[model samples]
Target: MSNQWQPHAAELAEGLSLIELSDGLGHLDLGDSEDVMVMGVCDDSRHAMPGYAMLCLPRSEGKATQFAESAKEQGAIAIISVGVSVDTDLPHLHLESIAEAGLLLRRMFKTEQASTHFYGITGTDGKTSVAWMLREALARYQSAPIWSSGTLGWMRSSNNICDIGNTTPSLLTMHAMLNAACQEGVHAVVSEISSHGIAQGRIAGLNFKTAIWTNMGHDHLQDHGGYEPYLATKAGFISDCAAHGGSVVANADHADIRERAPESTNWYGHGLDRDDVNLGWEQELPGLLRLSCAGEEVVIEDIPIGDFHAENVACVALTLMVSMGIELQALPELLTGITAPPGRMQDVAAGYGQVFIDYAHTPEALERCLKAARKLVRNRLIVVFGCGGERDREKRPQMGGIAAEFADAVWITSDNPRGELPAVIASEIEAGMAQPYRVELHLQLDREQAIAEAVEVLAEGDILVIAGKGHEAYMEVCGRRMPWSDAEVAERYLHRKHPGSGFDGERLCA
Candidate 1:
């Protein structure tokens, strides 16, 4: 972390009093004076600088006191922890709950009054897509600079980014990023709010400009203990947004979302029959999407094809217009500039047919992408996908059932079997496909081999859809992240089988 992000952190910390920070945490300060200034905030002792306050989260695994001692040795001025007590002479404070961390950190960073707007997106799918798409629109069209934090990383553009190795960053990291964005003159920040992030209090004390619900489905059930609880966690974020006066943009297509979203929501979806904005779109041609807002028809051309893509695009449009105050007349020029986040519905044209690589790990996402591929298929559509380990295990067979129902053939492969046997995960997936195979079913534990085998089966006018782990460059197996890329592997095998295949160099299309 190079002293945990250089002195930019120290710059935020400069002149911030430990007493004020303690009061923000609802703790009594033992500082010598209110002048006891903090130079930075850090969780890792390795990055502790002079006057830095070491923030120890509860998940630090009983090492908070040891880490605080080390940070004190490194010249840290203060310590903030939960339950753990530091023996050092530094001014130490405790948080009653982890949820207070975000508000306290925001106060410490002085970002509570920043002029920047925050748009938070959360749902089962399309979070990454909408986050990037909105950032693209705001960064290109709006005069003020924009940034997005999500699966692709914290980025202003495709090339310009800082990967902090998190989808929803921790409170310290999030406050630091927002502080940095404010320092950079950024006006809008688009962030994907995951279910884990919501439940874990990663975004506590955050006031959203708009809280967007893309759609919800069966994912992350294991973490929440059931689908009802998972839905509740997701819905609570949106409900909180409305309760706090933040604008809500909801996808009206999902009954779950529709039932949960507040009355003040501006909605978009193929199912919406609204008097304000009706966004039921049909593909006029391959890659052409026709969108309507408040009876004003506009066409968004040359985009990724699917109902899910349409849903994502519509969500972006609503956020732009309803929440962001963008005019309908500006829709065509603004919407056309947006692109799907990398590894989402990425396409490649081979000698036989097209090949698609997508981050469709959920059942709804997999079915949507496979159905989209079917639109481009003249003969057959085959899919290659798998679920992650240590996640919602119920979705394993559910995704398998979706694959069998949608694709003409299936290649079930390992995604990220972290600490779980890939073969065992595959067996659970296979249990979903109960009937004698309607088409051929290939179960290959080696993801690269599964992709290659799927590529070999492509025929003239046959589309190969590789789902799950779309833009990811590593496979997490047994707690180790091994280097891997589905796009690169598929491209290499596509070139081997069809010598004419090569990269389009834009979207990895070959």
Candidate 2:
């Protein structure tokens, strides 16, 4: 039996013709004929199979022509490129741009236009939280399955979750996932749209029914070259949503988002202090989050403990209000059961002091996580964190400064030092702090040892926060991925330090 998967014959028959695909290409020569059937389309030539149409896009890795020979060897029936000719028997279709061809291919494969309502959430911090919350809320009311794709992974319904590597997968993979969801009768699809994904045209062809904007911050500066470009890339999603006759839920607290938000569409703003917003949240005592919208208020008692979570909840509430049209009065009861996503402010019992594992790599994220930790710590707050190599290096010193300002003690360690030396990365982070820092600092190159030291020094009523590499199952070191988990390592160290602490590797709810 062949290991290759094939698409439905009916779908192939209904696929767009070459003439229709090249309709927008001005006077470009589509060699031979335009009557050939496109059974499948792909950008990666390595994944090409018989009857597949390969897209030769010029990427940073190499030119698309570099892989055209391999694609032909694998039995590609057609090649789409921008005036690049390959010595193969396959039909060559020329276009002005490769991205245009990708968008056309995405439209061809996306057959779930009618059954699914797409919601796109884009921002620096709360994309995953908002997407997960929306999925959970919609699942309660809708009969069909709810699919969420983002940092955590692609999830079908509540129990089925799988990773697709990138937060936003390639257009080809996205269309395949959407088609599968359509086959499974999905009613809603929520996705976290990253700036890189938007700028790189990963989500080019899909139209969303609702678009959400979390707060903007300093992130992906290296990829975007600057903050303004990154903000523009995210803002473009809202414009696309508006163009499709969809509504937008924007964060009123962010001036950039408020300014870029579509004024003509059904725009709903959300924030803690903005009176113009449709939804807002105010923190209350005894672990209650009071949510208000349109003269109606709902107080949720089972609120997750975190300052950042309040803002995330407000975003989720606003998104749900716009997407599902659920009454604010009913949200209090519906929201009490929702939980935070894994590796995001996840708490574990460590004798008397609590241990938190979070994927907070950015300076702002670290500051917010420590602030939330400060509120919960009874005695002291100790943080163990590190900056990743080959990322935004400018944030290294900033993170170190935030750690010094917030944490009682800091342990700077390696965080996926992909190509750089671990000690060098640690030193860069240390450079951000004041001379003889206000708090005690420990530099450990080995992450596991750093975690062990933090756990061993934990006193009763103190809190230990393990930041960065939250839900990741492996650590990248020198181009190789090794099995590692911050939560598991922390738990093992905690058990070793205090035997019979009843730490069963389970997260403790706040």
Candidate 3:
């Protein structure tokens, strides 16, 4: 067995023949035999398989054991774990970081096939909405395009969708997806860029033509360690776009984004009035918006409800104009017929009034949702919302304060309270309320029942805003996902009460 290593690559055994191999023990390399194929690389060894190379990273003993067990079933060729072992007869090499192996693979395959336009969007909120909306709009005018990596992660130009867990996939998967899209003659690729993805170098070496900056707020503090780190990660996306002389559309309304604007002729500012340039929503209506930009008015009617959605549409619209060269005058006509993204201020027809299911988990997003719900109705605005467990707990009570201020009736219910007591999370949120109001402290822990109860109590001319799990089709609890949908539950209850009404917003049961 021959042992050779590369310092720069941080990979073990450059080219060696595996004379002997074991699923539990490492590999023994002969002087020849360079045809070993690696099936997949994972940090957890439990997923390791037989007939494949298993690279177990140091400080990941659990992963190494997992790999050893799973590899036995899959018929793995060799197991490469962290640190050095001299007692074993198997050939072994040391590695500094397992992530380095993934990078090495991409470097060896460094070559471009075709010119692809990539649009990357990053922010605390609006990342998914902007990415999805841009892809949908671009399809109407351009040729068949392929977009991957966001909520669902992988969606082809053919609209074949699959679940890839990360907001930004691994470097290997991302490049592979991009390569596939290029081979299919895809015109563009739209993606949601997360802060963790940027910091971890997941998007390294990828060529992006356009980038959009949404407002930055307090979220993901645990991952980034602080607000400054979070902001820096987001700024990196714009910097990458600027390096290629690509257009970067920034939110002028966000002071942080405006302050961190990069130097590029393609850079365009979209905001409300500043230094003789004002770009934003002219008049925002319920599910409609009059978007004005660059002295042109594009009234986008029947859009997703929410005050902040108007701003999101503005960013997407301006991005189209600056990056794809879509005409501004033709935008209103184009966007007027667009459909709202799922779970984002989605209006569910109830028997008594309209019910809105939104993914407004943050304080700012909740505030915008409440304010928008207030305008769309004649009588009162009722909100049913709760914070998720094991997340940013500080925002719990703050959201409670917003509910107290904006909502006519507030129902604090469990929202994916994973591994945490529902009562504890509700108590934290209740601490922030300033005024006395009709608050239903339901520790039901069942989201469907909460929505059903809220719908049953709604009167005429009232709106029930179900905030938290917007487009998600399932509820996650105790590391397990359960089938659940707020919209489905509300619609089902509404239909049973009002026969033949059939999903209309105006029909009332009582």
Candidate 4:
């Protein structure tokens, strides 16, 4: 949870033998000196210390041997890896698969026995929004503090936020977070579960009290091997919750999800009957939201902007009604306090022109965001976005095409580009568009400069949307993470352009 870590496990105070450490999770035999005792467990070589059992994780890059060497030199008592020992000096243990280690990790951290309720939201979209909404609604309903972990990292409340390192962190890292959350008096936890996390068994022994599957679309196609695998991965988590006697809530609008969900799964979406959970907006944005549950409806005057928000609200409402024993009629008061997770269609002051920041990298999410943003303005719509490197390359062109189709002006720039050339990524995105000369299109690799130019060209009533890195504060280039923020950068330019006018999102300094 914290940036700095001193990895230690108190269960091994007197030290546990290597055989006992492995249990059924590890497979390695050292006939002699098999009783070597390990005081703690750590996977990071830099954090390894005397009497610690180190885990050798697979990496896309870097030498694995060097990591083991560093840990051994630091006095690691043994090494647990995905496969058989890899020429290591320390006593070694291996697993049949990476997921098997989840059991070992759960026992090591003791989170499997914790009473804190876990709620998971998985899918290509709406995970972050749904998780935060659940957290906010639960915090208002419960007496204990609520903690959530997702794209924006871990945060117990508005004033308390910490880095979680990933959308779904590693098994070890997640255990550490849950352990910390339990220690901090948190009785409920809401988190986003990614496909990679599910495939890798990050949620191993943590039985979710309820899980929601938002709609899914084109995303991480390569990582999951294809559409079916990706769907299966996401559905696998939902099914896991259902199989474990936990509640399951799915978006009925998504046919794939509706068809795949368990028979007992509770559904909520656009056009359901009054008997089921549903949402109806009497008016557009800044209008009344009619949330119906079991033929009962509540009218909320102020609502979050976006068509998807209705579904998100309905999903949360259904979860509370079915799983948490809160009546649908009581939701009107608690629902008012629900807040949107930051960086999703967030509005900021831009003087004459309005600027919105959203983390819409996929085609569907981007289109939805642009449509919502377009409704907010009377003039031209300008957009700035770029695809992340080393990810699903197929979505890059689709995103570019979506931007061209929706925006009057498009600024193509760099986003992350972990190991790929920024220019190459931009060119691929540009390839999706036709008849736009390289010069005719505004292509800028420097993200800040791209945002500056986009902000400068904003007209009196035009709305500028900086998509793909919403609340993200860092840009990963090569192997390093550099400081960056879409909203902060846009705000600075807006402030500079109109020094006298308060340029905060609300247009008021306070």
Candidate 5:
């Protein structure tokens, strides 16, 4: 493999020579005066490699300095910790905050900043879809490569994508990806910024040229303490982008986002048939979504998708035209062949009505997916979904209630019950259903069996939706992530039912 992604120590310590990061008088022993070269930065000692700089952060468990010995044994050359001292041969640098130091370290190690326009999309539901659509739209108007980083990973191109393990990666990893993109002559980078990313300083120190707020919902409530803090965290991205002389494109359909939008910079809003929005969409036909932006109309045909997708498309168009300078007239042609991100309403197979696999884990997202699936199904709509373990437990009941309200038949199953009992998680979800004892509500602990049963019971005109683990390839149970795929399971069952029919997976149309 190429070493182009690695950042040298001298490059990483560019502005650290005379900087005073904290108010302390250098109380602790700052290690021996040996010059060190760092090949990488690691937060976790388990992932520490030779010549890496270990960033010791304070966690709920303990101080990160507790793992310094392990990282040193793994060949860490230097240590940067907050409020802790490690006695080792490695050089130690103390800072009041490890997150701040990490952000600064990112700035130092990153290659010459790319002129590439950076757009950040943050919200509860449509971050991935809007970012993916922005990447697709940018690819059509520019010759330089467009990079996208989010749940789908660091996408160098549509065909070449790699996972970085988070919706927004660590500050160091984010800079590394951006540096690599700049080195490869990428023109723009669009990333899905999450609330956790914003609150945790994962996206700190980077300047976004434009920020898009898709829509905020009641997800991640546990992480942010409540809905107010969650919304505030999402708003921080918009504030930072505007402070950097950038603009914001907001979803006017969301009242909270519209109210909290920044007044300092130019704000462009988009929504569904709203008079105040800069871009508005009206569904002219069953499968066609017509958008009117700046008196120019673009007709999206044959994609009898959800209103959420049309809203996502409208957000993309407004962001490109208002923030990125793409002409409004070019939207229709550019958006013609664009498809949703992998598993975001991804139609993996057809034949018996259709089967859609989406990453709709939140109550709002699940409701949207089922409502969209309802429009496409001529008969009954069956949904298979489950809440993730150790996440926002409050959303479990809400998701279950949405499934109960929307789908004709609801299948509650396991979804990455990491370190938590699958049955316990399913019970929590079942608690939200108004009619938990209804005959149509099927509770299956085994996700694969649940999917198979769902497929088996689907009528000819029925639609089957497997929600909650869209593009994820692993199912985490009892802290171990085993290999699993919702789309693959659905396909296998569909093929077993219709043997030798040459049922190649194809996009279903209305």
Candidate 6:
């Protein structure tokens, strides 16, 4: 038989028996059932299996109850819970931590694999972009098939994509995706390595071929507990990759990355340090940067706006060169057709001022994006943005400070107010801005109205940045998601005035 299902699937098929388990006694009653094996334990609800188990306490609100109810309804046979002591009549497994469950599964499903090539990218911000570049380049170098599993989605092709519920899927799911790719003859698999993923050992069993670091900055302090711990988590990627016989592709431009550079024989550098790096870019336009790496140079081929992305592109190029052995000479020619990843720094042209949509939630990214937008604005830089609910609220003020310093005017609006009041979140942001900026601040809770106001106030040379949402199609408000698109609203406003003069159909506008 092909290595497809191998011995694990056979074992899973045969040993698929229902087991009732509980850690702490009496108070919690776990319902028992037959024919249900809770697929290892995981805290991430996105990776929870319907027929498996779920640990719900770590989440903010009713995540556990909601997930349990949903999973049971979807045919989940068992639940591994942490918080509620009273377990339902459903088959259940309770453990101190989900990690314990994961350990059990690994031991039970011991299937050995010969080879697996994982490309891991970690950074404070640009992890997704570097991963994307590496994925694209691998597809070019190896005529063999490839697939990408990240926050954006699983890209079977440039055109064919699937939703990725998590930035980093659980170990079991990661292996499953890789197994699927291998079954399909995939030669390369690029995955985004979040700090949490590295810290949690989600990518443990997988062997990596290359590790890329876009840059390091402040983020995930709440999860990591502090900045030092967060930095350590990011550092683990390079260390782990080296141990796995994979090369490190690091950005020499970043101070933190440079200081914590890992030891690797196949190390390649990328950034503004052209004196000792493999990749660098020349500023071509206000927001466009011409890329040059190895022996090739690709003119600004409609880059995803913002200056920070230039570094991201370089990191991707260098990773491709080191991992797949692709020459830089081929980049310029190949990049001629490449476009910006969905919402990294996508520019949407409006009739009056140009609108740029980006996924800049962090303070560093917000600062970089605002500065980049400022550079391109001849008249004024208008910003419409907000902070997400149930996230790192500490950065709210920092984000406001960055916008105040760069954007000529800003309209603070709601962005994924998951469970928090939009007005409350907006107020937190407003409190961070300087008093002088208050005059320029517009409080328009309706994102569409904010975009409309920005467009209406925009002149010919002005630039409008509609940020925080980026490529997402829905707006999460008060525990529910509403179908909304900043790009759509901007385009509608544009079309209402100029019919075909927007970036709606064209990749880039003149």
The model with the greatest lDDT is: 1
**lDDT by residue for model 2 over 199-231, one digit each (tens)?**
766776677788888878888899988888888
Model 2 spans with C-alpha error above 4 angstroms = 1-34, 60-62, 82-89, 110-113, 264-274, 350-353, 504-510
Tens-digit lDDT string for candidate 6 (133-213): 666756666755577777776777666666656688655566556656655667778888888887876675676778877
**What lDDT score belongs to each candidate, Candidate 1 first?**
0.79, 0.76, 0.67, 0.77, 0.75, 0.67
Off by over 4 Å in 1: 1-13, 23-25, 29-35, 82-88, 271-279, 348-353, 500-510
lDDT, candidate 1, 44-128, per-residue tens: 7888888788887777756877898888898888888864555556787778777677777778778889888889999999999
Better of 2 and 5 by TM-score: 2
Candidate 5, lDDT over the whole model = 0.75
Candidate 3 yields a Cα-based lDDT of 0.67
**Candidate 3, which segments miss by more than 4 Å at Cα?**
1-114, 157-159, 265-279, 350-353, 438-445, 503-510
**Which of the two candidates, 1 or 4, achieves a greater lDDT against the reference?**
1
Rate residue 389 of model 6 by lDDT: 85
Worst 10 residues of 3 by lDDT: 1-10
Give TM per candidate: 0.92, 0.90, 0.81, 0.88, 0.88, 0.77
Which tens-of-lDDT digit does each residue in 1-510 have in candidate 5? Answer: 132332222224332331233224232334555355556667777667777777665441354556888888878767767555555566776666644565555445654355767889898998888888888878887855688889887787777776677898876677766666666778889999988788877765677888888887878798888999999888878987887788888877678987888875333344344557677877644557787765667787654377778778777777877766777677777777667788888777754548889899998899998888888788899999999988999899999888988889989999998988989999999898885355388899999999999999988789999999898889987778898888888888888888888985332321
* CA displacement after TM-score superposition, residue 252 of candidate 6 (Å): 2.4
lDDT per residue as tens, model 3, 1-510? 011211111122233233322222333442244445544333333444444445554544545555455554555555555443322222333334434444333432332434778888888888878877788778876755647468655666324666666788655456655555665678888888888777766676677788878778877777788888889889977887888777787776677877786855233343334343335564435667665555666677777666677777777777878877778777876676665567788766633448888889989889988888888778777788888888877789889989888887778888888888888999898899874555544444566777777777778788889999887777778888898777777787777666776555343211
Model 3 error, position 498 (Å)? 2.3
Clashing pairs in 2: none
Instruction: Give the candidate number with the greatest TM-score.
Output: 1
Q: How many clashing pairs does model 1 include?
A: 0
- The better-scoring model by lDDT among 4 and 5 is 4
